[model samples]
Target: MNIRFDLRQVRAFLAVASTLHFKQAAETLCITQPALSRLIKGLEESIGAELFTRTTRQVELTVAGRLFLGECQQAITHLERATHLAQQAASGDIGHLSIAYNDFSINGVLPSILDTFKEKYPDISVDLVYMPSHTQHKALLDHEIDVGFLIGPLDMAGIQTFRAALERIVVILPRRHHLADRQQLYIEDLKDEKFILGTENGWREFRQYIFNICIKAGFTPQVVQEASTSSGIFGLVAANMGVSLYSDCINRFQRDDIAVVPLDHDDYSVETIAAWSMSYTTPSFRLFRELLESRLGGES
Candidate 1:
């Protein structure tokens, strides 16, 4: 059986139940006493119970009314909580954000940005994932992630980008290597050296940048081995496997076995960009982007 009632009836019952005086409850609800009485009568009829004992001198709840008062109070409390949460979500105060990042970003500026964001909006949940620049482009287009910090010069339809960091290309060498002692070296000096490079899967865009710079420097690097991650590449170079060209962001780490040497070339630099899909957006993501923009001094 369907017992039909409405919020107005529940509220009226609560008001009357609280005050135990029809005139006072009616005044509290901003309604006439006759209108308040009609609402109560309709509610009692719908529930098929006499909810109140009425007399000229006093008003009291029946046993059924006492039980209902408890349940009604809980229901109203829950409804109010739901309303508050909905408002918070709409304002970007409490929600979840999925972020994708690559080597240059995670090792450099992304952590500081995230820390500040969390401090300001503690209720917003953030999930960070490791992805390459090429993969992040597709993921953003497919709406798989909210934002991505990856290799720069990203030009694609339906995707927006911001340059987050501009790091000069540097060479990593074994500590015992002859050139490691030099204050700086040119890209041409590495033409004859064995290079440990990142593999095509996660380093496609960055590998292209390295190749372009090397070609400009009058020689192509001789790749002796390839690794899939930054740590792996660093490990290979540290173990004396081969030298590699990478962004200066690697300096953020403390590794005694490897030397980070600056390149003399002034034109070549690696860019870390933050990208998002224009077609997909959320309040939480907007807040995240706003924080990024503010930190970057409104640069896009």
Candidate 2:
């Protein structure tokens, strides 16, 4: 009566209540009969109620025991269910994740990664945001987005970058262009041709990468026009406004007015990285990273 009671008492009481026998309940609970008896006595005394009636040959629940039993069973069930949900959350099996992506990533590697990830962890609710790399960088910094699939090198502080895909730069020219019939085009081939490119916000680092590629090819490209959207870039190229360089992934969106040709250069590939705040650590983010990394490896 003077002893403290806790979940141990509740468990012992449940076992004995279910079996209506101390020796048998002790066996089920892996405890000594004496310990089980003490636990039941303490729980009864602490609650100021006799939960069971005992005789020389019989044990039966008291009226109070019958009523309390249902609630106790519910309590145990709820506790077990809550524990399971917590474990799932810790393991990245269930949660919400906000992922920011660029235009090229949406068309290319992101879809496969998302499909595989959703198939494996269907409980996770994902919010996809279409944004440029520069905007995504700021969102990552502010913790607005969980992660970003964008072109690199981000070269920013407080951000961790993982290589998600190696995207090859391809040439998108008008179907009737003299070079359209060529199987593959080199950077040198486009040196003299006018270029259609994304605006600064659309691809800051990637724009520089493109410029470097042209510079590496021994000539500066003449960017005669700029388009903010991928579809707009295609429209510009289709109209014969200028030829453009885009990720090989864009070939999925085939246009009859445009000729998609692969680039034949050693440095034709651009590295697309998964970027996140270095300080932010979430199981959902880790799960996404692992799945994306696997998808990227399979792609290569």
Per TM-score, the best of the predicted structures is 1
| Candidate 1, position 55, lDDT | 100
Model 2 C-alpha lDDT versus the unseen true structure: 0.85
Poorest stretch of ten by lDDT in candidate 1:
77-86
Point out where model 2 deviates above 4 Å.
1-94, 297-300
In order of appearance, the predictions have TM-scores of 0.69, 0.65
**What local lDDT score does residue 88 receive in model 1, on the 0 to 100 scale?**
71
Clashing pairs in 2: none
User: Per-residue alpha-carbon lDDT of model 2 for 201-242, expressed as tens digits?
Assistant: 787767888899899889998999999888999999999999
By lDDT, the best candidate is: 1
